[model samples]
Target chain A: MGNLLEIKNLNVQFDIFGAHVQAVRGVSFELNVGETLAIVGESGSGKSVTSKAIMGLIPNPPGKITSGEIFFDGSDLVKYSQKQMQKIRGKDISMIFQDPMTALNPTMKIGKQIMEGLIKHQNLSKNEAKTKAAELLKLVGIPNPDKRLDEYPHQFSGGMRQRVVIAIALACNPKILIADEPTTALDVTIQAQILDLMRDIQKKTGTAIILITHDLGVVANLAQRVAVMYGGKIVETGTLEEIFYNPKHPYTWGLLSSMPKLHAKTDKLLAIPGTPPDLSDPPKGCPFAPRCPHAMKVCVDHMPDYTKLSATQKTACWLLDERAPKVDPPATIGVGGE
Target chain B: MDESREKLLQVKNLKKYFKVSRKDTLKAVDDVTFDVYKGETFGLVGESGCGKSTTGRTIIRLYEPTEGEVLFDGEEIGGKLSTKAKKNLSRRMQMIFQDPYASLNPRMMVKDIIAEGLDIHHLVKSDKERMDRVYHLLETVGLNREHANRYPHEFSGGQRQRIGIARALAVDPDFIIADEPISALDVSIQAQVVNLLQELQEQQGLTFLFIAHDLSMVKHISDRVGVMYLGNMAELAPSDELYDHPLHPYTQALLSAIPVADPKVERTRERIILQGDVPSPVDPPSGCRFRTRCPFAMEICAKARPKWHEAGKGHWVSCHLHDDGLKK
Candidate 1:
């Protein structure tokens, strides 16, 4: 249960034109051996950039990790050279992207596309990789793997294409899997199937998972720990129960209340007031001050420090400041219990 | 209620089939029937390629039906109507498309986009009147009057959707078919759009056919709901009744798949994970289209299509398991 990956004070910026767009600003978290950590946020949040930094996939010249130390299995990934990082990418750590249609090669057969990773990373023979490729397809629940493996990517449906993508990510038996919005483009029924498959695979293989999604429902059902991101910062970090039931940050409250639920009966949902902060030129004070319902005079002047709610929960909000008034979420949301 | 006031729009045995190949036919909307009461939201929920969108589009005559009738205000659309009668009918029915980015013309300004409908119907007399009406419509959807000069690219996804709503309201339509209006928006912005739609519906006394893929949002906005599967209506009931007591196996499976945000509730609820994928519409299986994945599927399910019958006072289901005319 020791830390498998620890990120400290991560800062990622992009040089758009002449100004620097600070996307990920001083974010930190830890992922244990076999636990699932979900990073939840809206579109422009830096959840994707932090994971991209770990995989060394950020395009340079415009993008740069200004400061941070990404420690993976007692080794610093930020300090690794391109050649060194290449060895660890697919062999030790794997990532599955959001859109499977664009991820897979449309012209190549499904079997060859999956076997390329095995051949390149594990140095398996042509015949050996082909046989193992079929096994991987079968493992991911694709029927008649032997016959379907030779078909091109366009022949498979959207859900099956995603399954093939999952099989590729699992081919090398990597210790960590980073899935970024794997079910965003899928239908709800297919999304449920994929979520179930990921959970089942994590249980069987004990692979530490980092699921990056905008879906709060997925985080509630899947992740052991949750990190709420806003304006490229971890505004809140806690277990699923603490984040959902007893959210301290106003942004987290907006997220929970904005989510359309099956049981809630109301004609108009309580939408958050304003848009996400512009990342190109972020505000000097609290990033979420404009949209926060409980904004104070001090909140507009200074950024809040991270306040620890418990050993496992911490939130960065001025309302959580000791001198600030004790503000609770709406009465209907209730406290952190059933 | 009387029959005239009970139904705002009634679609009977609606069919929109496409000739895929020389002999093969795709039943995109096969024998579907439903009614949208006046001033109520009728939700249609289904998976992709399940003909939910097709049904909505056909109702507005975007795709002409091969058979069946679409009656809006007690008059059959696409029937032998006089030229004046057709003109009056066009002003009463309108549709809001799925993608706001694609639905709005890129070249047109916000003012012109909203005025296009008014210009088509010649509802406005002068330039000043049209400009004032367009500005008023903008304010109605919570957009500022200054947005009239801007283009679609100038606004965010949510703002663009507000502009789309403004255009739909310009004609002053009585019935609106909102096809996944909030699906492309961000989660934070989705609530804003849904709330706006509900507010507008209430203020305008508009009948809506809200089509979406998410059951949670569907349950929030809809008064009555219909579940479609492979071009057929699988179940139809009141929103609260369907959520509490889902009868059809497909509907039960869909409801169970929705992930509740509470950990304790999620742990207590059992997820019904259906086996296999949805069959291709080009060559769907015989009888029940969901028989390939239905856990309670039987031999009769594969032999013939189940007859749509009322299982309760208002709840309707089309499955052989509940065809005995006995309420579950």
Candidate 2:
């Protein structure tokens, strides 16, 4: 299948106190049709900015896509105006947010909210939209769809509200769905349910998904391909097995070791010792050099080039260089980089 | 692990209810009982609105218990006490809150925030003594002496949590109740806080009632863990045993839902996705609170509440499925 979305050299910046902060710098990745791709990173790692820039949701004055090419359906979205972007947003590529409570309008009925998307995107009449909205609700696994349509957002629970949000996003049968931290606010069981629902929906509709989250477990469970982001760049990109089992980047090693695994018995988690860099005044070298345990002199002086390990896996790290010292990842790590 | 160790805190049938309205009452923590041994970490895990935090707060006497007994160091601490007695009890127990930004006082310097417990109990002889003690505590929590003079806002989320820990340890309490302390921090910073807590437990010989929703961290740090559902204890077992052989359906579902960092295991494992959201605590199910969402619920589950009984050595579970061969 052809590529559903292509983000080439995407750069996003934010203005803070007269200082320009580059939140996303030169991030590039592609998503094929009917595939699930996850963007994983920490708080200020620019994963969210890449998703926002794709949908033209980056605010003006402070937030701007300084440069990039976002090609979808053989068209560059960067040149599109607000009106053009709006027509393509829900119809071609829809987006869902982290918090379900705020995503929904409190005063509006859930039925009307779902119907509004259909009425706008499909240009359907009131009755047709309402009927289609009910079907969408049922597709997202909402019980009592007919009765739930009349209830307001306040009446629904947290997980149910997220399901309603998903229904709205899928109202127009968009080709790509961008979910940013979809289940961060939910409990584990509820998070599992929501993830299962999204996976099931993808199988039935073949809609490409851009799952933006920091949880590796979620990425492993749902995403077919994973991109690890750090310091506003894609530090590593690989299939789930390559990322989890054959990771090469030092930051990826640090991330994999830091998480407390449910199945493993470890006394202390290996914490990467240092904070993320200050984006307002970014440093010259790699963003993770200060915290990396295997840092060499070259990693301190300049950014590493992308080294391809296989046809589908690549990482940006000095440690992957052939001439570099044979410093293996600490023997403490459970998987990857033997 | 230390079965003969003295019980530092004992709660029996503890209940904390809030008057949501004139006609309705919210059972925040209902008929709960547990014992925290000296120098051992006891974990409490549950979903939101499941009353895990309320259980911790009630144990620390932050919320008044509606009906039950709390025995501290073998003395009943349930009813009213004298001013001196209450003040002394407060010194023996302290709390570490979840939100480091909101918990620390913005107006006060880091020293005063940590020394609030010392000031309340008249621990210091002079201003210099208090300052020295605060500086010493700053070093204990991996911060420097220079940070003692700064305000809470100056520190990051992980550093702010260190301040909260120093405050909880200022009065030199024997037991600490940490309520979701690391949930607010990032993934990379969470390990720092967890390691600090482990070091403190070893050096000070402190008992902890760690309350959080993250089961993996809870298992790593806790000696014994308790699973609560709808303000009631569903299962209680040692850390390894509970994870390896979960008896209750709710506990099994919870353990199965967490995603391991490994891709092979995560994809191969069978995840038990519960049907719907957790039921409201105010009007919980008739018999078993988890019957509404449990996969193996039976008719008797709605007839009577299952008694918490020992299914194996050191493994206690409250479930209709675990009620087996008792007719013998």
Candidate 3:
């Protein structure tokens, strides 16, 4: 499969009160054609910043892509002029936000919102756009698409609003879809429906997805490959099984063991101690070293290199070093009563 | 699981309705009943607009119930009471709000925020004693004493939640109503708060009415859980029984909807995606509230409300599918 989008050493910085906060620090990943890649992280981990950078949505004054290359298809999106990027944004690569209501214009009808992209990018006529809008709504599993097209956003339920947002994102049929916490604002059952719709659409359309979320359960259901981000850096990149079962970094182990399993009774969760790093004054060593249970003297002073574990697994942690102490993960790290 | 355990709080047929207009009334919580044991964590879980939060708020008397009764420590707290009795009830049953950012007053220092309860209850004798108690509370919630001088904005979300916990503990309440306490926090930080709550429960022997939308976490911490749907309780059972063998169709759908964080399990597990969104609470479906989206819904399910029946040792379910009389 050909690479659809590649982010090479991407770095994003925000200037506030004469201080530079490094939001995304030297992150690199690739999205294969028709594959779903999930970037999992907590709030302020810079997952959103990296996605916004890809879409040319970063504000220059406060937020800037300090260094990096966003390669879409064979061209670099970073070098593209505003005029050129505008043409490619919706037609080639589109994005969905966390909140559906904010993403949509409440004053406008749902049909015109979906058709706006069709008319702008594809240059379709008003009638052609209207027909396509209903088809898009139907594609996203909304019942009575023709009638729903005439209704305003406020008339729709939260889940329906999200489906309409998905319809708008899919209107142009972009090759790469970036969904940033698309289901965070929804209920669990509604979240399941939206995830199902995304999977079903991907199967029929073959559109590659870059799903950015903090929920590991959503990642397990959707992503083929996983990239774990912490304090604005990619700590680990692996296949789904590798990331979940044979996780290398301590941060990944902390995230897995901390979760309260549904089918089992655990007396205590192995919660990572301390808060996330402050980006304005980020740690000098590993971002996770402060919270890691097995931190070493070397880990506090230096950032380790990415140690390749398998054909598709790589992690950045000093514990993976050949000379470092071999420590087994806590027994609570496995999933689903394993 | 023992029947001999003392019930700390009893909520019987609690109904809270909000009048949206002159004619229309939104039944946020209607006819809900449950009991919380002396030192147990009773979890209330459901999707948004399912009335779990409203149920908690009603029990805490944040919202006046339209009907039904609430008895705390065997004393009726639903109707009007003396000023002294109301104050005592407020101290005994404190509430921990969900959003720490919005719950804490931004202008106040951490010391004053934690000591507000102490000052309001007149528990402290002097300013020195108040500061001492605040320092002790900060330490109890895993925060340092130095944090007492800081403000809410200076702390992280996790730290702010710790402050909130300290504030709740300052009054030394026996029963705390924590409504979605960990929902607004990050994943790693959520575990921190849950562990803190568990540790505090053990140390203080405090009862918790933990209301949240996260089923997995609820299962882990709750001794028993009540599943609500569209302003009605669907099922009530021990956490293990509810997760392992769910009886209500809505509960089954909800359990299956939660994506387990395991690729192998996710690939093989059969998911039951409930059709359509939760119906509006204002004009909820008749008979069984979940009948609109239930896969096994029968004609009688739409005609009559299913009686709450005990199917196992303590597992209670309200579903036509489980009602022996209806099944026959």
Lowest lDDT sum, 10 consecutive residues, model 2 chain A, at A329-338
Ranking of all candidate structures by their DockQ, best first: 3, 1, 2
- Candidate 2, residues A45-147, lDDT tens digits: the string is 9999999999999999799988989999999998899999999988899998999999999999999999987889899999999899889999999988999
Better of 2 and 3 by TM-score: 3
Docking class for candidate 3: medium
lDDT of 3 by residue, A47-74 (tens): 9999999999999889988888999878
Output the number of the TM-score-best candidate. 3
Ten residues in sequence with the least summed lDDT for candidate 3 chain B: B319-328
Cα interface RMSD of each candidate: 1.8, 2.7, 1.4
Q: How far does residue A321 in candidate 1 sit from its true spot (Å)?
A: 1.2
Worst 10 residues of 3 chain A by lDDT: A329-338
Query: All candidates' lDDT scores?
Result: 0.89, 0.90, 0.92
Poorly placed runs, candidate 3 (over 4 Å): A334-338
Tens-digit lDDT string for candidate 1 (A1-338): 88999999999999998888899999999999999999999888999998999999888979999999999989899999899999988778899899998989999999999998899999999999999999999889999999998999999989999999999999999889999999998877788899989998999889999999998878877899999999999999999888888888888888888876776565567798778888889888888998888999887788888999999999999877678899878654644324
Residue A4 displacement (Å), model 3:
1.3
Q: Tell me which of candidates 1 and 3 scores higher on TM-score.
A: 3
Give stretches of model 2 more than 4 Å off: A332-338, B324-328
